[model samples]
Target: MKLSPTFLSRIPALFLSCCLLLAFGCSDSQDAVEPTLDMDSKANNKSANMMKEYWVEINPLNHSGVTGQAKLVVEGNVLTVEVWAEGLEAGMPHPQHIHGFVENKGNATCPPPSADVNGDGLIDLGEGVPFYGPVLVSLTPFPTAEDGTIHYKQTFMLGMGDMIAYQALKPLQNRVIVLHGMTVEGTYWPTLPIACGQIMPGNSMGMGNR
Candidate 1:
C-alpha cells in the first residue's frame, strides 16, 4: 500500500525520534564506560608514579662506635640505598638481608626473619633485592664524608636483583632498615642491629608532590 503525504511526514518524525533515543542511549553508555576507564587509567598511573618516586633517608644519631643513616630511593623498579656512618672504622663485609617487621624501634624483635628483597613481607627475595639485576638504580661506595662520616650508595635497575621479599611488602607501610656491625658480606651481625631505621611512606617523601 502506498502511504499518503501525511503518513510520509510522520515517518520522518518517527525516524528522528528513534535516532534521538539511540543517540541518548549511546551517550549514556559512553559516559558510564568513561568513568570506569578513567578510574582504571588513574589507578595505573598512580601505581607507576608510586614506583617511580619512592625514596628513604636515614640520619645517624651517634659517633663513638655506632651511629649512621641510610636513605633508599626507588623509581620504576630501580632502587638506590645509601648509608652514612659517623664512626665507621671499617671491617669485613657484613651480612645484609631484609629483616622482618620490628614491633618497636627500641626492641630487637624482627618479623620471622625471611630474606626480604623489596622489604615487603613476601617470602621471595627476588622481588625486593634492588641490586640483584634489573632493579638496581645506583650503587656507590665512598670514603667517610669530610667530617668523618662513612657513606655507601647502591643503585640497581628494575628486574636485576632478587627483590621477591621487597615486592611482597605492603605499599606505604613501615619496614625495617638494618645496618650490620660490619660490611654486608655473608655473615650475620652481633646480638642486635648496630644501626636501624623504619621504611616510611615507601620513599614517597622524596617525591615533589603526592
Candidate 2:
C-alpha cells in the first residue's frame, strides 16, 4: 500500500527522535562509569602514599675500618631490612641492631670516641648505649663475616611491641644502626660497637607522586 505524503513526511522526525534517545542513553552510561574509574585511581594513589623507604650509611666507630649501607622499607605493618658491609672482623659473628630513643627522650646518634668513659680506648655496648639508645630490633642469629664482609636482608611483621618501637622511629632521622663485634682481645669485645650509622629518609622506587 502506498503511504500518504503527510505520514511519510513525519517518519523522518520519528527516526531522528529515536536516534537522539539512543545517544543520550549512551552518554548517561559513560557518565556513570567515569566516577568508578576515578575512585579506583584515588585508591591506588592512597596505597602508593602509604609506602615509605629509608637508608643509612654505616661508618666505622672504633677505628675498626668497618663501613656499610643499610636500607629500610615500610609497607603497611611489614618492614624489610637490608644491610651490606665490609671490613668487619673476618669469620666472627656480628650482632647488628637498630637502636632508637623511645618517646623522643633524646636524639639517637653514633657514639664518638669521647663515649669511652672508662678510657678503655674502645666503645663498649654500655658506653655506646647513651648515644645510640637501646636496641629496638636485633638483626640476629648474627651474621658471620666470612671474609670481613656481610650482606644481610630480612623482612619482619610488626607486633604490638615492635610496632610501638617502630612508631617511635617516625621522622627517622636520628635512629641508628649499630654493628657489634671486632677482633679486639677482651670478653666484652664481641659486644663492642664496631660501626654505626643514622637512618634517613630515602626515595621510594617508582612510587613517588603515585
Candidate 3:
C-alpha cells in the first residue's frame, strides 16, 4: 500500500528519534567501559611510581628477645632502608649487613653451621665473604630521644654489588642480614651476631610513569 503524504512527512521525525535512541545507548555503554579502563590506568600509574616492598622480620640469633623489622623500598635505582629494633642494649651501634652470596658457581652458597668443614669452632666472616657476598649496608643506630635507644633508617643508592644482588630474581636471594654486637676485647666475632633475618623477595618492580 502506498503511504499518504502526511505519513511520509512524519517518517523523518521517527527516523530521527530512533537515531537519537541508538546514539544514547552507545554512549551509555562507552561510559560504563571507560571507568574500568580509567581504573586500570590509575593502578598502572601507582605501580609505576612505587615498587613492591621487601620486608624482613628480624629474630634473636644470639641475644634473646631481640626483635625488629627491616624494610627495603626500591624506587628507581635507589633503595630506601628502614630498620628498627627492640631488646637491644641502648646507645649501641649494632653493625648490620647483607651477607648473602650471589654467584653462578663455586663459593656462591650461604652455608649454615654445617658448612664449617674444619669444625674450628668458628664461622669467620672472611670465609663467608666468598660464599655470601660483601656487606652491602653496615647500619649505625642513631640515638633516639629516649636514652640509649637507637633507630636506624637510611637510603642507599644501588652500588655494583647491590645491583647484582637486586638483579637476582630468586626470592630472598642474597639477603641474609646479620646484626652484630660491638667488638669486645678477646672475644671472637662469631658470637657477636645478636640478631639475624633473611630478606624475602617480593613482586617485580614496575617501570616508570605511564
Candidate 4:
C-alpha cells in the first residue's frame, strides 16, 4: 500500500488521541465506582449508630414467687425500660433496678438460695448484692403491685454518671434486673429480693423462664 507523507505523519497523533480516550474512559469508570463504595460505607455507619434492644427474664427468688420480664432499648443517649411482673405483694410498692458490676470487676448474676449467708433462708438485698452488683439504675417512682401484678415503663436520658454505668453494662449479658419487696412480715421484708433475672440480648420470644 502507498500512503502520502502527510497522512503517515499524523498516525502518532491519532494513536495518542486513542490512548487519551481510553485513559479517560478508565478514569471515569473508577470515579463512578468510588461514590458507590463511599455510599456503602456511609450506610454501614448509619446502621452501626442505630438503636439496640435487650431483654431479661425475671424469676422468683427467696420463694416469694414473683416473676417478670423486662425490655431495655438504647438509642443514642436515650434508654427506655419496660417491666412486667406478677405474684408481687398486692398494694405494696416494689423497687426494681438494673444491677451490674463496675469496670468488669465481677460477673453479674441472680443470687441463688445458697446466697443466704445468714442462714435466714431468704436472700435479702445485701446477700444478692455480691452476685448482682450494686443497683446501677433504680426503676422508680417505684411501682406498687396492683392486684398482685406490676406493670412498669420509663425512659431516661443518659446523664454523666448513668452513661458511665452504662458503659460498664455493655455486653449486658453480665447484668441483672432485681425486684425488691416481699410479702413476708419482717423488718427486712421491704428490702428482700423477691425476683431476679439476668439480662440477655435480643427480644423475649422463645426465652425459657429461669
lDDT of 3 by residue, 65-131 (tens): 5677677777643567777677765543345665543333123243356545567643444444444
Better of 1 and 4 by TM-score: 4
Q: Assess each prediction's global lDDT (C-alpha) against the native.
A: 0.36, 0.67, 0.47, 0.67
Candidate 3 clashes between residue pairs 3 or more apart in a chain or in different chains:
90-148, 91-148, 101-132
Whole-structure CA lDDT of model 3: 0.47
Q: Between candidates 1 and 2, name the one with more favorable lDDT.
A: 2
Candidate 4 lDDT, tens digit per residue, 13-56? 53233234334423332332322213257764664467888898
lDDT of 2: 0.67
Ranking by TM-score: 4, 2, 3, 1
lDDT for each residue of candidate 2 in 1-210, tens digit (9 for 90 to 100): 122355335444532332343244233323323222132577645643587888888899989899988888877546788888999988666778777665454679999899999998988777887898766666655787788899989876543332332344445676788998776664324566899998888843442221
What does the lDDT read for residue 55 in candidate 1? 40
Global fold similarity of model 2 (TM-score): 0.69
Report the candidate with higher lDDT, 1 versus 4. Answer: 4
lDDT of 1 by residue, 1-210 (tens): 122355336345433432343244233323322212132576645644654333434332111155554556665445666665555435323223223321121222222324344554332222222211111111222232345455666765433332322233223234445443332234322212344444555444443222
The TM-scores of all predictions, comma-separated, are 0.41, 0.69, 0.52, 0.71
lDDT of 2 at 182: 70
